[model samples]
Target: MQRRLIASVLLGHYLSAFTALGIPLYLPRILADLAPDAPLWSIGVLFVLPTLCTALAAPLWGRLADRHGCRLSLLRAHLGLCAGFLLAGFSPNLALFVLALVIQGTFGGAMAASNAYLATQLDKDGLARALNWTQYSARLAMISGPILLGLLTAQGLGLELYRWLAPLPLLAFALVLPLPADRPRRPARAAGSATTNIRLPGDLQRLLAVQFLFSFAMVVTFPYFVPYGEGLGIANDALLGLLYSLPHGVYLLALPWAQRRAANPLGVGLALLALGNALQFAIVQPEPLLALRLLSGAGMLLAFVGLHRCLSQRSRQGGAGRLFGWYDASGKWAGTVAGVSAGLLSQGYGIASPFLVACVAACAALLLARPLVACPRELPA
Candidate 1:
């Protein structure tokens, strides 16, 4: 039963990842079609809009999930995605398109929902493993989604892909429907349960700080990555897409080993991320830069997995739905800020400048890493 539930969650996440992570890749194209005269900064703002909405909305959803059930929250998110995509696909004007993005961001947050649901069933170690596999699903999507988008674009499907992508969440919605209900029973809690008033522990606070910084460092590089590659003179779209996804490939292939061998995954991962981003800014050559990106990918796996492990340890203490909600919001907020910063940096400095900024953020996050690895004492079961 546990195995089946885990599989369902992972598969659901995999399906949702296409829209969450992959669709953003085509934002530039989508903008070109929908709002041809949109300014350069608009892409950055638009790219992060959904994320900002998610950050603001997730905690409220989390509170609802804590009161109701995570399965319902998860279902709601999928449906939200379906609606958001359809609206965006059919949008006749830029204002409507922007509204569609707002709806998308406001409603979609399946990853947090999935995490909360899994936390209800799994032990700390099991939850960690499940979260790791969830990341695997996302990484796999990161690799395949772009390649597929590139192929569809080559066939001249063009912006029609948005319409094609609309049904993906419906498929995910169907996939998650089979999982058993995971809400806490009404009888189990007092009438005035303080689910909404739960406070973050010191360790979790540190981790959230790390999450924000780490997310900012990583995401700031996303907005201009393809353009940066083009600036480096790598013109093959397919090859550029592959290079962009190489770090995730490293995560899929190397994470298991890092999980077993790393003494302090968070710290080590941050250090590597800082190093990789620094190298990316320093080195302009495509060949060596590709290899160096793997270093950053390796760091991503360790840091993220380590963070999840710490989170799992804390989930039961504060209620998974609320805690994961806050965590997701933290990361989303970071992505939002990073997007704005990336736009400003790219406009003022250069496309490559975000990588340097990312390196600095990663280094700053390294300062908060000690609490994550050291706070493993058992909480109330």
Candidate 2:
């Protein structure tokens, strides 16, 4: 029954992500159609707006879930996402569209809510495993979302598909209805089971910091990645799409192995990420760039697995809804800042400049993560 619930959550996560992921990619085009005279920076602002709002709103939602139930929170996210997408689809002007995005970000925190819901059903190790599966579902969505969207776009359905994606999350909502409700567990039960007795505030702060830096570094390079690739001389759309999906592919293939084998996955992952980003800035040739991209992907797998392990352990102590809420907020805030910074850096310096910034952030994250591994209670070998 637990496995079935996990499977349902994974499926819901993938479907929602697969349908909604294309919006960011298609934003510029969507903006062009809606407001041809809009400034370039507005596109960036709009792109980041939802994330910014989500960061601000997630904690409140988390508290709500803690007070109510995670199952209810999960249902709310799916319905909220559906409403937000519908609003965006029907908006007649830019102002209304911006409002739609605000609604979307403010209420569409399904990932965090889902993680919190899962925390109710699993132990530390089992929660870690479930988180991995959730990440895999997201990675799979990233791999397939664009391809499917591209096919539909090519079919002359065009922008209408954006509106149509609004209903996908409802399928996820229905899936959640049959799952058992989340009941609160006693603190003693969690304390008795946990392998580590983590001290709060300090440990939690470090985790939040790691999450922030990890997100900032990864997302900082995303906005202008296509332009950077084009600068490297890859012109074919199909090939470019393949190259773009490489890191996600690497995650799909390598994360499970990394989770099992790496003794200090977070430390090693941060090191690889720093190296990959730094080297990427120096290398101009397509082949070497591809290699570095693969290296970065490897780093992503280890780093994400390590982080999820820590998160799972922490979430076990009850009030998981609130904990995961803050956790997701940190990452969302990082993404919001990263998106804005990428646009600025790309415009002022060059498309490749953000890679250097990402490298610096990764190095900072590496330094920050050292203490985490050194503290035996925080992470498993």
Candidate 3:
């Protein structure tokens, strides 16, 4: 039972992780198809679509997770996302492509089920650490998914390949069938209400705000980054992939350490995210380039891992999946706005303008959490 539940819960997340990374691998292709002549500023709006869907739909999804439990959520979302991604493979028009992405976003809420499953089932102290490890699976997927997509891209795999990848979520839904049902308890306010207010409890509100600010600040690149790199003498899309991976590498390296040492661990997460954003704002010349990007990625790793751990620890009774649903949803929403704004800002001003915004947003988030950073719990967890 334990093994099945653990695997079932863990497997769905691993699948989601790959899908998240895989989208970027095909980003260049998506860009070419939509706007061969489009300015780099357009990338920000592209980044926003799924994010907007997630932002709009998360609380409702959380409520759904509370009602349907992990199994139904997975089953229902499996069918929807299956349709969504399958359609994405065949989207001839840019509008259809955007619609497909939105559909994918709507079903992304299935992740709430996975989090609730973990929060309800895992032991405390032990679970947060374990959750960190689960997150590590996502980083690991970053290593593999891009490489896989790159290989496919190199071989000229196009829409057909996406059609093939479309089955993965369905397969995941099938694999998790063995995981036993765990109907986690929820606060009456969180569960029974017909409407889910965007406003939440104070702690949840703070956490959500931090997540929003964190993603918002970092999203300045969107489509503009490739051009930024091109200006910096980057050769192709592959380098961009490597740049994305560099941040994850730093993040994976920081997780265990941050999980162990950071005070007001969640606050540390916000601070690290701030530092990363600040670096982008600070560096104008490409002379100190590689090191600055690396440092920023490390900062992000710390912030994200810290925040995940804090949320997992705090939601011991209400169920991990449910709490995570809110976390994932809020983060996605923020990411959407950031992506759009980044693109528009680049279009309206220069690419450099977005960095200034990133720095400002990140700093604000860090300050918000400063008062709380001093209270981190000790680590039997």
Candidate 4:
């Protein structure tokens, strides 16, 4: 049963990751199909709109999951994803494509739901391991999804086929159906529970803020890397795809080492992130940029795993869904802001400016993470 549960969770993570990345991976191609003459800045708006919707919707879904059940929430999210992707695939114009993305965001809370469900089944150590593995799956998807989409687009398969692949998550949802169900944890006093205020710890709040900054920095720079590389006179699609994926590949490779570190992993991760982003300003050549991207990927993965582990430890008391929802919202909101900012900054300054902005944001996060680093580690429950 445990093996089956783990398998199901990992599979779900992979599918979810695939669905999340599929569109963005082929955004350039999709944009060409929707609007051949669209400016690079418009791409950022495409990202911003859906992420803004997600920022608004994720918390609601999380609260619903806490009141109801994680499984039901997961199922609903997957179905929504299916419908959203199908709508995107059939979309005739950029406006309709944007609407499909909004639908996707409105119905999407699967990542938080999955994490919340797994939290119920695992102790601190197990939860950390599960979360890291899930992150690993996501990183793997990030690596493969773009390359796969690139290859398919090259083969004349078209970007719509990728959008049509939304059923993958639905299949994953079906796979999860036989896994043990988790009932929502009802508070001791129902009426009081509904009315009572729950506050997050100072450390968690700081951590979430740090997460927002880091996410903002990442989202701001990530979508523009292709254009940045193109500006550098490297137009080979495969090489560009590899360049974009290098960080995630390195991130996936670095997860186990991150999971093993005991002392100030978050600090270490943040420092690495700071260093990697700072180096981006110096590296203009393709080879050096690739190496720097790899470094950034490893650092970002370590930071992510450390932060998520901290969140899982704190959320063990209950309401995991709600907490993860807020966590997701924080990142999504940050991404929303970053998306718009990416467009403006790139338009006003230059394409490479976002990387410098990312570097500063990462340094800020590193400073904010100091309090978390000082807290004594807790044992698995």
Candidate 5:
């Protein structure tokens, strides 16, 4: 029964991620098809607006998950996503498309709700394992979504196919109905209660800071990787696609190893993140750049899984949903900032300069992470 529940949750995560991310992967193509004369800045705005809305909405969804139930929250989120994607599929203009994204962001709490549910169902070790597996599923979706889009586009059915597939996540959420119902376990404290006003642990605050910095660093170079690669003289569309997916491939491969033997996982992950970004400076060729990206992917997966595990364990007292919500929001906010920064750095400095900024941010996150890992918090049994 537990295995089945886990499987269902994993499936839900994969489908949600696939649908949410897949369309955006084709944003450039979608815009070109819908509004051929749209400026490049429109792409950035399209991405940022949804993310901003999501960042704002995450906390409210988290609180609802905590007050109501994880299962219900997941259902609501998935349903909203289904409707949002359907609207986006039929959108006649960029304004309507942006509205669809806002709807998706406002109600799509699949990732946060899933994490909260798993945190409740499993012990610390089991939670870590589940989180890693879910991360793997998400990474797989990231890799496969783009490929699926490419194949469909090749058949000249890209936009139409995306519209048709928009509600696929709704089918995935149907599987969630068979899983055990998640009732709210934590009763709300009365207003002005001592516990209600209590602050987050200092270590948790530092951990969130690390999350923000790492997210910013990762996004700083993410939107420009293809352009940077092109600047490095790799012009083949297929090769560029391969380069784009290589990090996720490396992350999938490295997950098991990191899960098994990552004793100082947070510290080690941070160090690897810093190292990977630093290595980008020396890679002037495509071959070496590929290797650098792979290494960076491994580092990213390790750090993210490790930190999420740490946060889950620490917040297990009943605020898991809220904590994970904040976690998601911080990353989204950082990504928003990073997107703008990446553009400015790319424009003013050079295409590759954002990587230098990313390297610095990674290093800063490493420093912030050290104190938290040194004094690890204990989880309740």
Candidate 6:
């Protein structure tokens, strides 16, 4: 029973990670196919809008997890994702594509729901392990999603297939819902539908800020890397996907180790995230190289794993659902901004610039993370 619960949580998080990365992985092909006529700015907007929707919807989903339960909420969110991404495959215009993305974005709470479920079940040590597993799942998805999408697209599937692919993960996710609802006295009140009942604490404002800064620094790389690779003579499609997946592949392998050692997970994540960027900076030659990016990916995984562990620790209160919603919201918003900014900048300066900016952003986050380091909760008291 315990092992099943852990598997469900891990698989659920992996599925959500697959959903979250779909756009960035497929966006270029999507724009070329569906919105070829749209301006670069408009394409960027289509990218940002869904993330914006996720940012808005995460809080609601988080609360829904609190009032009802995370498992059911996970099922509901997956249903939303199935519908949204399916529509995206058949979307004929930028507007409809944007609509599908918003739908996907709104359902992005699958991760939050999974987290809330784990938070409720796991004690501190358990929560830490569960979240470490969650990080591993994300790295696996990041590696797998692109490779899978690339393969599917290779068979003339193009990018629209995400529409169909999106539904299956959630459908699989729904299979695990039984564990959380052992008693099954579900709320039927309309007011309790998707909105959260738990309130976020005002005192944790600084924590949220640190979370936001960390995500902001890291998210800037999403939309720009593929295009950057293409520009730098990465002509083989398989190689391109490999280049993108390598860093995450390395990260996935190391997550368990990091979870064991970090005393202050968030602070450690922030500092390492900054250092990861610096490593990227160190590789900032005149062009983008796949090998260097792989190294960067390893650094990113370490940093992001730390960040997630910190947030898991922070979300241990009764308002955990609310906390997760806000945490996810910040990451979504930060990614949206970074994706758009990278898109615009890529229209001119090329790929090295976005990563360079990532380095700077990480430094800023490190400065903010100092307080978290100094005042960690689980100190040797």
Candidate 2 vs. true structure, TM-score = 0.91
Candidate 2 residue-wise lDDT, 1-381, digit = tens: 888999998888777777666667777777888889999879778878888888999989887787678888998988888888888888888899999899888988888988989987788888888888888988898778877777776675544665889889889999998998886532333445763332233488888999899989999998788889899888877777777788889999877677786465888888899899999888788788778889999888888988887777666544777788899999999998898899899999988999899999998988887877777343321
Residue-pair clashes per candidate: 0, 0, 6, 0, 0, 2
lDDT of 5 by residue, 1-381 (tens): 788889989898889888877667677778888788999878888877777888899888888777777777778877888888888888888788778889988888677778877866777788878888877887898888877877787877644655777667788779887777666756646677745532345466677789899889888888888898898889998888787687788778877777787465776776776777777855777678777778788788878777866775576736667777788888888988999999899999988888788888888988888777677775442
Q: Candidate 4: worst 10 consecutive residues by lDDT?
A: 192-201
Cα lDDT for residue 160, candidate 4: 72
Best by TM-score, which number? 5
User: Which segments of model 4 are wrong by more than 4 Å?
Assistant: 31-42, 92-96, 188-202, 230-237, 284-287, 376-381
The candidate with the higher lDDT, 3 or 5, is 5
Candidate 6 at 85: error in angstroms?
A: 2.3
lDDT of each candidate versus the true structure = 0.82, 0.82, 0.66, 0.76, 0.78, 0.66
Give the worst 10-residue stretch by lDDT in candidate 6: 181-190
**lDDT, candidate 3, 15-53, per-residue tens:** 765765576657667668655776764554565666678
Kindly give the stretch of ten consecutive residues in candidate 1 with the minimal lDDT sum.
Answer: 194-203
Candidate 5: misplaced stretches above 4 Å? 190-193, 197-202, 379-381
Q: What global local distance difference test value does model 6 have?
A: 0.66
Provide TM-scores for the models: 0.90, 0.91, 0.81, 0.88, 0.93, 0.81
